[model samples]
Target: MSELATHETSAASFALSAEQEELRSRARALVEREGFAERSLEWEQTGEFPWANVKALAGEGLLATTIPVEHGGNGGSWMEGALVLEEIARACWVTAMASLGEIGVQSQALAAYGSDEVRAKYLPQIASGDLICSVCITEEQAGSDIFSMSTIATDDPDSGEVVVNGGKALISRGDVAGLFVVYVRWSQDPGMRPIGAVLIPRDTPGLTIDEGRETLGGEKLYALSFDTCRIPASYVLARENGFKKMLTAFNGQRCLNAAISVGLAQGAQDAAVAYVKQRVQGGKALAEHQGIQWMIADNEIEIQSARQLVWRAAAAASGGFPNRHDAAIAKVVSNEMALRVTDRVVQLFGGHGWLKEFPAERFLRWARYGPLGGGTPQIQRTAIAREVLK
Candidate 1:
């Protein structure tokens, strides 16, 4: 963001504009029409990518709304992305998770800092939903502590290219991504200045992608290994002082993560509401039970609170990433709120919630992924404290 842009007043209104509402409606319709809710169970069971839903998103023009308009996208803001993601997640967490790379931090980093050659090569395909990029940031020693990452991108004296060595664990989209935006130590410079990033094509030699453990949300995580992978110098997104740039992108991701969490919690609530209305207990409907009513009330309270926070954070950014402080606060609130709300939904379902055959248990499992993905609630709290102290 430019100095002038930074000074612009952030819109605090939580109400969506006509365009934003239209986007939300489109996403909601797409998910329901395509039966993503039903298909989510199959995805968890088969472990297959939801290719049909991806295409459906593309058809509805929701696939790459976050990328710059010049790059074949609508150049929508994070708020726009949030509206879409939340609706999608409300129906299927798996599809929402799959859409992250294209509409998330990885795309933002690549679009903001990548060389024209790299962005021009990948952004168009991503906007078209024909491609997805796995962001490689987490290493064995680094998850939230990205500065502790040992991945190195050294200039090759002989080949006049960049040679990368080190690995990332628990990366999404590795098995199917066509491109990689990898964060690495770019120089011997002390502190965070040396932490930069590079772009490596998925097919680059010595770049290996291997399957790893499945996540609670039923998405497969993968491990990335770079064994002296050599790439053109043009692939360098930043050589130094890129940490701030990446973080700006991450703030937006945090907002979106919160938005999805809000949606997941609401989805579970939706299921619980329908079930309680129909299921009879003792002599009356479960909805009439005081205990169930109180649980429902609490779920609504948490969901609405998280939604408002997410909207504020997301709306803070006009055409760029949101304020870091706002983003962190929203993420932590939504992450914990979703966990509580989803758990209550499971309990409301009684024995049916515990069975894998039901949706309530699955919603709880999906909510577990909220804090674990963008950053843990602990990490977000630390960030919040640092902001306040500063």
Candidate 2:
């Protein structure tokens, strides 16, 4: 194991190496420089994707970390990716969301499964933040159940093309994504199998993206409709293996979505702690109160547990270890852990937490949205059960 991992067990308080220390400082500086603290309020009010900050992150090599250096990327590991996402989320959750779409799921898809031509065409653009992308799954009828997707793609024998039809709902970055990794059911295949994915350009004919709607998490999402969208035969990524490829992408995102929640919950905890120090209660500091002190202690415990679970999950994936079951458990616990922590922070703040002036309410909203995004807590438990019993 590397020195970082060796020292991480007993007391994570060990000093960072010269290089690791430099990266952490740089990452922290970037967030502060980008007005990440203020960006959340702006995104909440405007409901617009933070492109400028994302491009800046690209400039910082944050977006390029995971893609291999051979593909014009920095070739960092999942641990680095998690650190970047956490720091970025500390400043602006919306930026983290937008970045997660490109840096996490989209990059992984291109790196692992894309054809040589597709990788050559897209990976550099993705790393440089020149072209933003989004995963096109989660249809109107198929939120968590991928098996129920109605979107269908048919192969044309005459021209060797694939025609796509159906709508993708609540697609993050959908309205502005230059490229989309679209999942579709292969109509020609047996068993109504979900077996096709293609890279669809935004400029393609018969592809229209409606304006994105505002979500409670201050997310910008769109309903993407493909009416006989024609894609070159070369664009089929995985061909008859669509389900596996899509699951790969979803697994990455599910872990990532949980990380974002961890950051938001930590942010809420930080704000609450600061408030308790300054805001007096009963003529004494709120931090001194036994009840408030217990709440603070509980927040620390839950936050640590949640963060460790996320790190373990990230590390397992990076190390190519068996991580699916652990990833699901981490995602579920972190999701609910964050929910409870943030809700408790709000309670600690009394009336101020309920107001927009404080971030507790926002964090609470985001924590609630977490479980529903990747998959519900119930779905996660079912997945865990299948593995444990097997």
Q: Model 2 over residues 269-379: C-alpha lDDT tens digits?
A: 888988999999789999999989999989888877877877777777853322667778878988899889999989988999899878888888877878888778899
Point out where model 1 deviates above 4 Å: 1-13, 188-190
Model 1 pairs in collision: none
Q: Where is model 2 poorest over a 10-residue stretch in terms of lDDT? A: 1-10
Clash count list over all predictions: 0, 0
Model 1: per-residue lDDT, tens digit, 1-390? 223112211232477766776677678778889998888889888888888998889877798889888888889999888888888888888888889778877788888888899888888899899988777889988888877898999998888999999999999877788888898898766679988889888889999888668777778899999998999999998887888888787788899899889888888998999999999989899999898899999998788788889889988887878999899999999989999998999999999999987789988999889889887889888889998999
Model 2 accuracy (lDDT, Cα): 0.79
Worst 10 residues of 1 by lDDT: 1-10
Winning model by lDDT: 1
C-alpha lDDT (0 to 100) for residue 304 of candidate 2: 73
Model 1 vs. true fold: TM = 0.94
